[model samples]
Target: MKKTLFFASLMMAAQLNFAQEWKPVGSHILTPWGEKVTAQKPHPEYPRPQLVRTNNWQNLNGLWKYAITPVNTKEIPQQWDGSILVPYAIESALSGVGKEVGKDKALWYTNTVTLDKSVNKNNVLLHFGAVDWQCDVYVNNQLVGRHEGGFDPFTMDVTSYLKKGAKQEIALRVWDPTDDGPQPRGKQVNRPNGIWYTPVTGIWQTVWLESVPKTYIVKTKQTPKLDEGVLAFQATVAGSQAGDEIKVRALNGTQVIKEQVGQPNADFELSVPNLEAWSPSNPKLYDLEIQLLRKGKVIDQARSYFAMRKISMEKDENGIQRMLLNNKFTFQYGPLDQGWWPDGLHTAPTDEALKFDVIKTKEMGFNMIRKHIKVEPARWYRYCDSIGMLVWQDMPSGDLGGNHWDMQPGKISGGNRDKARSQESEGYYRKEWKTIMDVLHNYPSIVIWVPFNEAWGQFKTKEITEWTMANDPSRLVNSASGGNFMETGHILDIHNYPDAAMPDPKIFGANQVLALGEFGGLGLPIDGHSWQQKDNWGYQSFKNKTELLERYKQLIRDLTRLIPMGLSAAVYTQTTDVEVETNGLMTYDRKVVKMPEAELNTAHQALYQAPTK
Candidate 1:
């Protein structure tokens, strides 16, 4: 007892030391939530919302020992420079080590965790929400797993590496090439300027651990079949025997509506009576309880939820394609949301901070958001789902300096030629995109998938578009938003600056949904909230808030007129200012709202109520 007490005291003293040493390292503007961050527990919430095991998991998101080493140095370091806040990039202010780790250096993180061996049933799984570029994970100095791709979550089983003790050591070595490599890094550059922003390195999302039974449910796909009034449910079990079964129960606020049992690794169709279709107005969600059973005895279980929603396309009376939600035409209008923070960079400061943007978007009376070349954390999409906000998810653009971005009204000659990416580059793109889709397949808020944006790294456009459609036929695929105008996919999207416009209805409106993928970049940079004091810019700079509001209202009026002329959707320039680009409804720090949300909401009602052909 005395020895354990002494060890506990030592640990407490060490934690206090770390708390005193850790501080946000930059002078850049910070959001209200960023200011509240501490080294004790940063983003301590459960990382995986989709697959919830309740208190059976642990968040590994506090300060950890970090070191910057030369790229050629493969051995683990004997000495560490200082501490870094886990799940934040080294370049970010919240990491407390605001130093850039470019292509020439590797970022190393190491930490110790205490595992309750008695409670951890059969297997221990180490999970990373995301790690930028490439990473190699070690468990007690043993190479447990290696993963690439900066956006997708990867898991490794670290049970075998455990000695017969509660304390386990974890280490990770990460290397991100940023722009030097052909990976799908979006808007990240070593020398950030204009539209591009700071380069993010190493871990930028939640890292955690989950303990589960020997036979556990890895992931489940819950697709809402609205037409048939059924939910197509499938579970992927990790370890299973022939008799192992999965019992699924659909609940409505603790009341079980329906239940079904099926063999592990098989599909189960559950009848949903009186379906309340999820939409921008009424986002109804149903709870789920899945249990893994063997010989009619429950061993493991998880809780999750899903919404019944459908997205499709149909031609109107004038033979113009129109996007339909739940078999009804709903004009979608929203901002181009680039999920970036001045403090955390790619990661949000807290879960509440992450949900704030989505909540604000819905409050502004926008039905949809074009996630501009950036994928947010899963919690961001969950907030969108619950708050009745539609999302158009874009694949992060990379492999630049080799593509044409022609967007002439009548002619798209320059964009016809695609970038010739090398074999490795093409392979990386394919693998990462598939992984991202697989990870985010269960979210209902995502109505559209944008494979490429503005001809950036666009290669084999038709092939890629067809594969995307075939992979998930549940959602519409925008081939390339404002990129090469290919006769592919379901939408023909274009971009116009500071004005609301759509594709020529007489030309491309017959077979495709006419959409203004980007427009209305009216900029008004507030004095203190601006990323940089001078040289801030937008497509059309405004002097004051009143002027900006007037111009934005005019753009909405123009966009309303296009709705009747076969215009299906329109995405404004952006949701918040990013770096030197001062074209956002809100400032980069999220401190000030350029226009009143009530007024913007009232003005946007006209576009949704506009008559369609």
Candidate 2:
């Protein structure tokens, strides 16, 4: 009887373990990370690292019952199709319900969260790390707020809808048109192929709750001036009184450099002695502590950091333009870094996974990476700063009209005559461009601002470059990369594939730094780890890792020659394979590193020591 009972118990345990492993019911699937996600403790870390608070807060990740509702539906569906892990996209394998909602429907998410007893005081603020397109939030059936921007974070005050000691139901409705609209959707498309991939909709970021006083700090901006050895700050507050005091402290290791007391919403400068400038070779960061005090009591405090560095353009020995880092020419060679994951789409599965790419890039000996058409989490940039990696930030393109022929590499034959954008579109583009600059202007590692890529929705090249320069004179601007070069801006950027070349920087005579904005897409697909078994392609296809490594080595060898020929920077096609594009150094699942680390690292280090003109 004991033996028979033990056998039955063993069978039950095995069944339970199998149930824990989520399975796919259709063609859609979950990411590898998705399968590992658990609702017991989901994305429990503080969402906003920039601005932090010690008030009542709760993470709303975990499992959320979800359904696909009609775009115009006003009532909640009585039946939920299945459960999805919060923060992961619906198309990801982790979401549990791998399905495509497309552009025609609104994806709805509903979850009930109990308010902690301590959070009953004051106003409760709900925050979202990001949402794809348009999203509306409702708490306990009360409409709370809505946001439009897809990439930027947004928040709403949900104090009025809270019931003390009771469970509050939170509902989110999202609508994303992706390529169907002119919004800055990046490289997302309905029918993804080649460069574009599947669309990310609904909540693709962290969702959490925070309790704050009626008045709080909304945001803060810190800018460093290396020449003057000063760091300038501007603080924005929601409920700041005219005479509110803000205490700022700058620390290096355990030593305090400077401290100052200032008024809210006013410019304050703190001086430092013997400042160490930040660069790709030496990224020096000073820690910051900010406190909001009322009547000599600390109401709120947050920690931040900044780097003191400068990026400028200067004439080289050959009278050609070159990019200067701290008054010295530094050749930047790195990957294009599309910032996509086959399983998570825009979101990476883990913080370590995100840092892995930057760490690997640095290990491979490249000092810079062009963040192509995607804005990574702030942590990614922080890692870059800690590891000393330069970043070229691209303002993701939007309104790229469908016409596959236009995107083809050699479809245009010789370069077609550069054309200008319509005045109306140009006006809207400028407005959005300014917003993007203002949002990302504080990062010191971002040395270059790429306004347009291959002329997609590109117009008024000269004017746009001028505007970027005037708005942020601290950084260099690349007018248009690879397409419709107007001989404007501080960088004469080009795009080459599997081959590296440069235009005559002398003929332009603008003293613009030369860079290859895009190149080197060598694809090799691993059978077990691909988005699809067939139809996978890259700029150049290879059959084996040995052959791919050889081709890569040849490309780097050729690029080294271009460094002395006025090449200041080069961005390799990508870091990982996405969907049907199998040209990444790492596989889509991130489980495999295709090439030997030693070989890739050795090849990458050649860029730093390569002789310059």
Q: Considering every candidate listed, which one attains the maximal lDDT?
A: 1
**What is the Å distance of residue 570 in model 2 from its true position?**
0.4
Q: Residue 510 CA error for candidate 1 (Å)?
A: 1.6
- Report the alpha-carbon TM-score of model 2 versus the true structure: 0.90
In angstroms, the error of model 1 at 169 is 1.3
lDDT digits (tens) for residues 1-613 of candidate 1: 9999999999899779878899999788898999999987788887777889876788888888999999987777778989999888999999999999999999999998887543383688999988998999998889997899998889999888876677888989999999999999999999999999999999999888888888889999988999999999998998788898999999887889999988888887988888799999999999999999999899888988999999999989998989999999999999999999999999999888999899898899999999988888888888988999999999998898778767865344443578899999999999999988888999999999999998999989999999999999999999989888788899999988978877888888888888899998999999999888999999999999999999999999988998999999999989999999999999999999999999999999999899985
**Residue range with the least summed lDDT across 10 consecutive positions in model 1:** 408-417
lDDT of 2 at 373: 82
Each candidate: how many clashes?
A: 0, 4
Error of 2 at 33 (Å): 4.3
Instruction: Return the number of clashes found in candidate 2.
Output: 4
